[model samples]
Target: MRQSGTVGFWRWRRNPLKRRSDVVEAWVLLIVAVLMLCGLPLAGVLAGLHVDDELQHQREERQRTTAVLAEDARAWQAGRYARYQATVRWKASDGTEHTAVADVGPESRAGSTTSIWTDGKGELTGEPPTEAQAASAAALAGVLTMGGAGALVLGAHWVVRLSLDRHRAVALDQEWARVGPQWGTRHA
Candidate 1:
């Protein structure tokens, strides 16, 4: 029921009741605050940049190639997104012909031309991420990495705080053991 008074003033106030643990906890909090402020955003940005570079590399590897349909795709379906898998043929940069199954609109027919992505080996591959997609992916990666950094920082803080609490408890126990037997010695 005592007055708790001001918040962070515990670190500055001259009070005999303040233990070593209180000062250490305050210092730990200050260090953690500084680190979190600098570390989290930096980690996020660095991770995003690294991921963006990787995405760019992948985009470079994937190139758009015009392929002719080797076989007719199914007739157009009523759904908005109605694509089916069918065979396609394309010539590689080395003038080598390759055939692979690709996703195409249902309305596409055999001998029709369609553009698809191919790797350097002329193998069909998924399309590369666009600019907006890359940005989104980078943001997601940044957020995920930032969360990981936060967890690591918080975990360290928890360990330090627990250690301080344990030390405080041991000190309290030692003090009480030394002074506990003097309670009834007022007349002695």
Candidate 2:
């Protein structure tokens, strides 16, 4: 009984070669493992990007550009449109005094305040992701979802095939036993 138990336990252990039900099962498992491995990182990356998008959307929806009453636009150089800078004061959600060098197209008037939001660089800016970035992120999410779903399907298929193989093997052995005596004339 101990010997039989040992044999059974070893058989039950995970073995790559012993687990294969057929060519199909092997192929399925291989495809699933590869796709899942690749999809894990992609899913993480997409999830991070999704969080960034959500944060940006929230910021855009909640923030408003109120005119700064106590601030003025100060140009650092003449004849240089892009090099112009200004100290603009803005109030945040927590009522913190956020000050930044505001740069709009050309230069802002001394008393005018354009809409802006705080970005990851700790700079209040007025730009968002272009259409190309959104399209690329959407494409990446779709690809990851498809790959993960494919992996899950293949894994399920391999598991079912293995179970069916075991069932059929037992049934075949029993059928052989039932008919063995009719053709049995052993020379030993």
Candidate 3:
């Protein structure tokens, strides 16, 4: 009698009808399982560590300093956000003066003092991320990396499965062609 349900480990068991393609497919599934369980998480952790290190380095290189607005800071609307832009001047660690246009508080006016971040060259730069922000960024990086890797692995597995299916279909068709004539003659 024909089996109504699938047999467990049929691919690995010694069956007369089992083809080489079945063995290959079973091995593919095993490898995919291993990668999903172990390899993907390792890649995610490495990616997160790399992002955290880079962010920490950037935070270390940034310097906070007080600057005086050289011109009145005019508030402007940008989409859902509001900002005040004005020219500001500050002295660098080398005692050289630098002037640039930057964003300031809405209440800031000419000659008002404000805090700003600068790079080692005394060029105005955005403030680096805080510890919390860096941690969040690292976590986001890790999750995204894991998601991307998982997608790639699953896609590859799908392709392999599709190819195996097609191969099995062709083999079945060839076998049917070879045996069908004999059965027809016996029936006649």
Estimate the TM-score for candidate 1: 0.73
lDDT tens string, model 3, 1-188?
64645575678888898899999999999999999999899989999999999999889988999999998988766665888889999999999999998989888999999999999889999999999999999999999999999999999999999999999999999999998888766443
Predicted structure with the largest lDDT when compared to the true one: 3
Whole-model lDDT values for every prediction: 0.88, 0.62, 0.93
Residue 86 shift from truth in candidate 3, angstroms: 0.6
Residue 49 lDDT in candidate 3: 100
- Give the per-residue lDDT of model 1 (tens digit) for 1-188: 54578654777678999887888888889888977999899999999999999888878988999999989886344476765867899999989999988888777889999999988687888999998899999999999999999999999999999999899899989999999898765663
| Candidates arranged by TM-score, highest first | 3, 1, 2
Measured by TM-score, how close is model 2 to the native structure?
0.41
* Candidate 2 lDDT, 1-188, residue by residue in tens: 45665663454456675533445455655666776677656675666577557645745554345535234555566674535566677776566677767654344666776666665443465656555665566566766766667667667866777787887798779989999888988897
Which residue pairs in candidate 3 collide? Answer: none
- The alpha-carbon lDDT assigned to residue 137 of candidate 3 equals 99
Q: Give all TM-scores, in the order shown.
A: 0.73, 0.41, 0.84
State residue 65's C-alpha deviation in candidate 1, in Å: 0.4
Which candidate's TM-score is highest?
A: 3
Greater-lDDT candidate between 1 and 3: 3
Q: Which ten residues in a row have the lowest lDDT in candidate 3?
A: 1-10
